[model samples]
Target chain A: MNPISSYLSSSIGRKWIVALTGLGLFGFVVGHMIGNLQVFIGPEPLNRYGHFLQGLGELLWVVRLGLLAMLVAHVVFTIKLRLENRAARGTPYAVTTRRAATLPARMMALSGLMVLCFIVFHLLHFTAQKIDPSFLALHDDKGRHDVYRMMILGFQSKAASGFYVVAVGLLAMHLNHGIGSLFQTLGLNSAKVRPLWEKGGVAFSWLIFLGYASIPVAVLTGVLK
Target chain B: MNLHLKVWRQKDAKSAGKLADIEARNIPEDASFLEMLDIVNDDLTGKGEEPIAFDHDCREGICGTCSLSINGVPHGPSETTTCQLYMRKFKDGETIHVEPFRAKTFPVVRDLIVDRSAFDRIQQAGGFITARTGSAQDANCLPVPKVAADAAMEAAACIGCGACVAACPNASAMLFVGAKVSHLALLPQGQAERTSRALKMVRTMDEEGFGNCSNYLECEAVCPADIPASVIARLNREYTVAAVKDGVA
Candidate 1:
């Protein structure tokens, strides 16, 4: 109890909480992108993929519950730390020149909030199929869930696709700062390897953006249909 | 060198502060930044006016007492303390905006002088070793690796300057705490209270109203001592390990 109290009360402890949970979400994001890329393999494989996920049965729910917990903790601790950071600066400088904080680093909390909203919207649109009830019961020719058709139809709408692209773009910026910062938070950042981690983070974020954006772009151009 | 200076002016902590424009003429290029200020103060005093108040001690950069944020850069544009900054660094007609180190924990005692005793409180929290002084240990008896010794010395080089807080967007004292933590944690003498040291110092830092480190790295860039941000990473690592150890214990 003493340890828990001290740990929770410390700022560095909160940072560790944010970094560890962020790592979990980052892994899920990568796994999800790869699974969605299966759409390029055609309806049978993609539908089978979705079916295989459901095949996990109760384990799938456990993972979902775990991710939800992680998301809640990450968001809560982040906001708390952000508020503390703001209060720490009692007076703002009359003139400011950026010496260290990059644009992406400065926008981290804002982008994080937007990404949170996007995650909820995405789950409603795709996972629950509640956003568009028309896609809820559709099946492919193989009698499997027509996830492929739903994706095509979902992206066919210019507004939805536009919203998705913007959301993913914000997600990319979030990752651009979050990834390199994780190394710092974990104390793995060394002077020798810091630049590699920083550049690698930007590269990884752009990669995720290109992968996520490819789906909507393909569907909108009638390539996926 | 003739320079236009906008220096922050305040009578006391309760009073409001403003930047006062004053012209400095015929300053020697070899004169230090503080010396130039001295000349200006002398002229004001001669004219029966109150001289601008600022902090100073050793003209040498060793003492962390001298502090000024020159033109938005802490300790001026040079990679040294304000006392060590030379007049030659500025153009003849250039205008310099000088302000005190700003942070919630550090309140202004007057113009260009903030009460940095928050640092003393943080240091007192756990920045020392409590070894018995029965007898001096032979240097050969305690075998420290060269790399570890060098790193410890680098961390120990911190002069307790508040520039890191002034330079930080969040006004975090992580770099200062990081330096002290690494300095102690690296040495065998500092092993007795390593776990508790990390916990107490961090808790005190938070209580003192300092911000959490966000990896901005501005502190390292503006640091006159050049204490690297990697030290801060080490602080995070040490704190994490300590917390986990305490949790299991």
Candidate 2:
């Protein structure tokens, strides 16, 4: 392996990967949020958007594969970095607090892992369509899987809606740190632009969380049906 | 004023360390932090107990020798070095907890004394100017910009203190190594060996088993010399460019 590649494989390399893949995931979240906002336009438009995505077919699969690769790289790098940090520090002092980190930056890895689990459950509940065959069986007049109806029915249970709300909350947290971190990694952040980036990250994260969570919340409340 | 001290005590490099509580009364509040420790050691010696061994010299704070992790913060709550800290910072009757710099690469030699010679070894690996002796050149032979000179001076201000490592969550010495590398590599006199210098220093830094930087910024927060973490960023860029240029990447 090349020395720089080997260096990247080292602990520092892991950080670079986290920063890079984190930027990729942040872009994905923004795009996903925008697409999801169509739900506010009612089922017809939302369903059309879902169908368009489904129509991508092989391209969609490529995108999914790319995302999976990014996720695996992110998680693997995180675990490696965490283990290396622990080994180097030996034992920590008793007092640990959030003072060392900004609110969202501190729980980034934890929130990211939580969001990862939620994503898995989300795919099973909707994408994989295997967890609930009855939901998968529903179809619209256009012979499309009634993704809108599935989403509505899926959130009918308070437990399911509540889980989604928390998941979105965690996703927001992950985005808060990740968005700003991407700029830092790219060497774009400076004293002049850093505060702007920080505030912009917070705004972007909240927008994404609200956009995604609104679908579940609206459906559960019978406002979308 | 009276003070309660909890000092970490270890017999040797391999020994398990513990906090040994001791009481010292009527200490002057104006004493430097190390002077307070000195008083405690004097009391211990008077009692026929072995005085706690800690590293300190040139109590004015330039030497970077007085290493202590006070109350979970490296060199106490102040941004200054341990030797520069004053006894007045603590309240009367307050308990002061002191420990050596904790990291895998910094093994404890005794109470509040760790062998930081690993840092010296790493520095020795690739941290000097290669300019040949007595090769006299005119001062005006090489005209360098003032901004570059200032940047180099700022980077050169690093005193080789392990505070960057001590304050870092992963105990990364990149800030220290980067400063050293940047100081020399930025100069017109040092550009001839920049690629080789960065590669050799970075490899030596890793070989010394220092952890990677996570960019927590704690090193900047606690650095007595106030060396910026930006130097580490410059170091990363230099390393990448050098590695590529050298066909090592």
Candidate 3:
């Protein structure tokens, strides 16, 4: 085997790949969550932010492609790792207990898959305007693409709002375990600050969850309209 | 005290195993978990029935030979080995389930015994220091910092028990491999082969069909030696550095 293959095939190599890609996606979420909060500052700022992003043209596509690549690498490696992990335990335990494993930790794959579904549905709903015809038609008085109205209207429905809330909750749970684990997987954790990293993961995950969820929640509750 | 056990019974590795229920009457409270099995085996033998087979040695929690998944937890509910588990931990007439360490790489030798030579093979790959025969160096010649020495000693505490493997959802041996790697990598004497040691041991561990760590931390909780999971992080650091260096080479 070549040196690269040998290295990547090892467990540590796979973890490094997972951690790096996960950190990238993590950074994207933090930025995206904060950016989405622009809805509260009124439609002018939020729509202008959208217009500014659209003005970037080709640069926007490049960033999107990069994020897409990171997402693919993260998901593919996770699946590969999970398959190998499943194969390691050929026999299932008759009576198993979740003694040390937390709910989010154990539900990583499930929540991850849920988040994936949400992402797809989300893009279709907002970006492509395929899921909802109204999402494509709405515009502000300034003759600009009213992203702020699109978001508020998109989440005004009970079903869409509920789905967004549930998906974001799952995302939060995934981040809770994934963020803290990134340190360990990357070998950044030490005895001195292990607790800080672990606890910090929970706090950060919840922060992202509440931040993202608040937008749809505000629209549904008529706070953002 | 009277106890009931639902012990796993398998004819061989290729065959299926089932839980064989057995009754232990008048068991003393102080009897260790292994002793209770022994008494049960004796009764089975006297009755002209096949005795239950389980692995045990040193019975003192040091050999890492004894393995049992008692009541759904590896090494029972205690943070100690199965041999160290006593009847007093269970209430009278409590029903317990005993099963061998089940991992794809660790096939059951019999009922409760599993072939754990994979660990020996991993250790053999690079878990030691190799030096030429010469005059012994002075103890103070290579001074290791107290923190480094303590960290190395902590990693060295693993008893090679398969509990970490058994407890892991993916049955990953990262903790075991991590402990083995960190123990040597921390010491000044182990510096000569540090890079190669990390690379070789990790390859061997992967080849042994062990799973990847998913950060569940179950190994730390169920470990008989209470080996922390941070050693895994150190092992990750060591392996990455080695792999990157080797790739460059």
Candidate 4:
């Protein structure tokens, strides 16, 4: 086999790809949460922010496509690894106990799958405006797409926002393990750095959870009119 | 102290098996786990019943030959080999589960013995240096730094135990491969084959049906040799460098 392809397909190399793409995805989600938190600053700033992204035009599409590619690689390789993991364990132990593996570490692929489902729903609800068609028609007094009020109106239904929070929760759980694992996979985790990254992973996961969920919570609680 | 035992009873590789409940009566607290098993086997032999077959050698924990999953934890709830485990860890009447290591690479050879030749095959891939087999070479000939020497010694402490494999959720052999590769890659004597050693061993590890490391650290927790998870990181680094060189060349 060609060395490059062989390396890319090797079990260790595959993890590097997963980690790199996960890093990319992690960046996007953190940025997404920060941008969405503009809801706290009130409507005009939030809508203007949305319009700014839209104003990026073709460059926005480039970013979107790039993220899509990363997501595809992340999901495809993760599922492939998960299946292979199952096959490698010929038989389940009659009894097993967790010694050092954290809850997030064990729930990695499963949580990722759940987060994927939420991503699809989120895109439909906000990005494509499929879940709530009225979101497409909503406009501010300035006639820009009213992303701020759209969010407020979109989050009017408790169920949608609840699922959003739940999805973010699952995403945070996924991040809890993934953030630390990427360091190890990329050979960046030194013995001293390992514990730091593990704790950092937890801190970052909670930040993600609070950052994203705050918007939905504020909307549902009528803090955002 | 008497105890209940759930021993995996398999006649052979081709046969199915289940945990057979056997009463380990009159066991002494000071008896090593294997001794307790010997006592149980003696009882079975005296009664003309088939005794539970387990793998053990050196009774002292130096040999990685004793493979048992006592109560789901590899080598029991201790950071030592099965031979080092004693009855004192258990309470009277507590049921202990003894079974072979489970992995696609390590197949069950008998009752409590899995075919660990998979580890041997991985070792044979690139686990050694090509140093001249003779009396100790002049220590002054090749100078090894203390940091490298210590790391190599730590990695070399691996007894080729499959506890890492047994404990890994994905049944990964990365820890074992990592230790072997790290040990050789750290020394000047091992420099000649370092690049190829990493490439071949990891390739063989994957081809042998070992799963990818998810960095769960379970292997490090259960490792009798105390092989740090950092060796796995080293393996990843070494392979990346070697693979890149191979690709570029």
Better of 3 and 4 by DockQ: 3
lDDT of 2 by residue, A74-132 (tens): 88888887777767775465332222556676676789789989999989888887777
**Worst lDDT 10-window in candidate 2 chain B:** B240-249
The stretch of ten residues in a row with the least summed lDDT in candidate 1 chain A is A91-100
DockQ of the candidate models in sequence: 0.73, 0.41, 0.81, 0.81
Docking tier of model 4: it is high
- lDDT by residue for model 3 over B22-57, one digit each (tens)? 999888899999998888889999999999999988
User: Where in model 2 is the C-alpha error above 4 Å?
Assistant: A94-99, A186-192, A221-223
Model 3 chain B: which ten-residue window has the lowest total lDDT? B93-102
Number of the top candidate by TM-score? 3
Q: What is the CAPRI rating of model 3's predicted complex?
A: high
Positional deviation of residue A3's Cα in model 3 after best superposition, in angstroms: 2.5
Q: Chain B TM-score of all predictions, in order?
A: 0.98, 0.96, 0.98, 0.98
Where does candidate 4 stray beyond 4 Å?
A: B135-137
Q: Candidate 2: lDDT over CA atoms?
A: 0.80
Candidate 1, residue A75: Cα displacement in angstroms equals: 1.2
Evaluated on CA atoms against the true complex, candidate 1 attains a DockQ of 0.73
Residue-by-residue lDDT tens digits, candidate 3, A114-194: 999999999999889898877677778887799998998888889999999999999999999999999999999987889
Better candidate by DockQ, 1 or 4:
4
For every model in order, what is the iRMS? 1.1, 2.8, 1.0, 0.8
Each prediction's TM-score against the native?
0.96, 0.92, 0.98, 0.97
Task: Give me candidate 2's TM-score against the actual structure.
Answer: 0.92
